[model samples]
Target: MITDDTTVNGVRIGGAEAGSDQGARTIELPSGARAEVRKGYGRDLMRAQRATAGGDANAVVFALIAEVTRVDGRKIVYEDVLEMDLADVMALQAEVIDENFDRPPQRASQASSNQDSQSRS
Candidate 1:
């Protein structure tokens, strides 16, 4: 998601969801540094993604949460964008941008899977 990190003129900020979630996420910042957030959320999902396929999933979990709250005192509402593929999230995120920005946001590519957008975070 191209997160509404487009802070409201100065109040800096920040899905995240608490259930079955997955895929690549883009958290737009005031700065141009590209942020891609990985790792799944939700108990059922955390176990399902099998983030390790076989390794230290706790570490992965820790890092993801760290990034979510790192920007000291930032208050954010989690916006969930469902689907496994990052590309899909990018496209949907673009649409979300369009809704927010008014003009059409760029879509990365065609979806590999046909599904409706789901917002959870």
Candidate 2:
């Protein structure tokens, strides 16, 4: 859902409410249940996560923390912060397109197998 206005760490955050990332992940399976790996950094990653919490958190907590820690000598601007969101949306769209409509590989492989079988016969 989209949020018209919200505050986080005092800055007004607009655009979409930063939704939590969720997806299937793989692990050691005991039986028939399928799984996938939803990638994330370890708890040492909380500072990075604050960026997604929106508003000043991106620059205040995440950006500043990284700068102070000397992770990088850079400042996260407003557009840069928003690009993170835009990037994710594009990534999600690619995955959805691949899952739903990308069948060229499968079709080509199957066709190759059929040609091989016909030649052998």
Candidate 3:
């Protein structure tokens, strides 16, 4: 989990999830930087996984990075990660994904609890 004090490039990064919206988060990096990271709707991640299965390591890495990281209020794409030096930002991107990806939103848990109660009644 990313804490509010987790800093990359001197800026803090944090994690948040609300309702069933998985694609809502805030990412902060160095150099007066901040971004809104969100979960990809699984299509891109599936495509990336397929590429990896086909022996495309580069594709998978960039795909995962792009799927999770956003910058300047825009979704980062494979081309975007390719244009930049991986050494500079890969760790930060990976950290954001590791901390925030693939988790059920808070509302989903609540809804499940509600369903369980109704089922028991």
Candidate 4:
């Protein structure tokens, strides 16, 4: 039963404060079920990439999840698709990848700006 103000681990999802720390965001499905999304750590990403390269969808999905805060309230601290349907799993994967994809561009642009300033100095 996800409300508009749903939160996971005390962080609001779908709000301006979402993804504020540890890349946390709340993912609410139309079925009134919700899950928290977080960016995977380095090893998680590495494993996910490897699994993706090997065409193992299950492993890839598992690698992207950091926690499931809403599903069972069990504080599961890893990818566990046993209770999640395909839609939820896919959504989690997409959110994780999207969050990861967004960071590099900003960093690259910032680096470029720094280099430009140094050159001007």
Per-prediction count of colliding residue pairs? Answer: 7, 5, 1, 0
Give candidate 3 misplaced runs (Cα > 4 Å). 1-23, 49-54, 85-88, 102-121
Per-residue C-alpha lDDT of model 2 across residues 13-110, encoded as one tens digit per residue: 55422321244223322332222323322332454555546654434433322211210223333244344444443333343233323255535578
lDDT of 2: 0.37
TM-scores of the models, in the given order?
0.19, 0.20, 0.48, 0.45
| Ten residues in sequence with the least summed lDDT for candidate 4 | 66-75
Which numbered prediction scores highest in TM-score against the true structure? 3
Residues 11-94, model 1: lDDT tens digits: 333323321134435555334334444333343234333533555554333333333321223422222222124553444344
Error of 4 at 101 (Å): 4.2
Better of 1 and 2 by lDDT: 2
| Selected candidate, larger TM-score, 3 vs 4 | 3
Residue-by-residue lDDT tens digits, candidate 4, 26-113? 7675455676655545554654566468767666556446432334333343445555677876676677666544564435578899
RMSD of each: 18.6, 15.1, 14.2, 10.8
- What overall lDDT, based on C-alpha atoms, would model 4 receive against the true structure? 0.56
What are the per-residue Cα lDDT tens digits for candidate 3 across 17-95?
A: 2222454576566544566666554655775686567758767767766766677766566677777655436555665
**Candidate 1 global lDDT:** 0.36
Backbone clash pairs in model 1 (N, Cα, C under 3 Å; residues 3+ apart or in different chains), count: 7
In model 4, where do residues sit more than 4 Å from their true spots?
1-21, 46-58, 66-73, 77-79, 100-121
